[model samples]
Target: MAKIIEAFVDERGHLHTSPASAIVADIAAILGRVGDEGGLTSGVAALILEKRDAIEKAFADYDMLKSSGATIIDVSDRLRFQSHAE
Candidate 1:
């Protein structure tokens, strides 16, 4: 988790990574390069492409929310309940 945090931000607390949209575009590029090899059959590749399309929509929604200056709301389970679930 610490490594992930460090990857996006430097010691001075500045962004050291590309925008989320750029990362999502990279994901799309990788999906486009998928081939029927390494157990990735044509059918599996089709499914990946379909899923990537849906994921792009989600990313666009987040981008809109951020651009609108809206606060991003997320849900977190209570620690007591989380411990029990674990």
Candidate 2:
């Protein structure tokens, strides 16, 4: 009669050891390479490129609103803001 040999295992029942930090580092490296290779161009990117000027204008408008301490209005027709008080 042969004796059965049993190996101690953890809850996962796997011998592979992997840390979370290693996985994150690998993902970061892959993303860095992808970014260097011109990034992932999707429909959203195309739309942004098409309306880049409008986006820049929108950001500038928001910054102006913050600096001038103006009141913002979001109407169905358009966005209107009052100038800062003197």
Candidate 3:
């Protein structure tokens, strides 16, 4: 059975998982609404667009994480510890 993963927003405002399609759609909608507001740095916009794929992948990996009962903190810690260990 396919598992349903819950999305979480941490204290830092970064998404715990890749934004779901619906979330991404909402963001795009909001960006469109504020498109003419100006003042956004090009680098920030480009960074967001660049991360689109990673965000999508995170959403796709959500099921895997849910099935394994892994938390973002767990993954983050493991990666950091492993990097230091090496």
Superposition TM-score, candidate 1 onto the true structure: 0.33
Higher-ranked by TM-score: 1 or 3 = 1
CA-lDDT, candidates in order: 0.55, 0.51, 0.59
Per-residue lDDT of candidate 1, residues 47-77 (tens digit):
5555877878989999999999985645564
Worst lDDT 10-window in candidate 1: 4-13
Please give each candidate's TM-score.
0.33, 0.35, 0.28
Question: Per-residue lDDT of 1-86 in model 2, one digit per residue for the tens?
Answer: 98865434333443223443333333334444434353543333445555769999999999999889775666742422333332
In candidate 1, the residue pairs with backbone N, CA or C atoms under 3 Å apart (3 or more residues apart, or in different chains) clash, namely none
Please tell me which predicted candidate would have the highest lDDT against the true structure: 3
Per-model clash counts, in order, read: 0, 0, 0
Residue 3 lDDT, candidate 2, scale 0-100:
82
Across residues 6-43, which tens digit of lDDT does each residue of candidate 3 receive? 77653345554654533544454455543356444333
Q: Candidates ranked by lDDT, best first?
A: 3, 1, 2
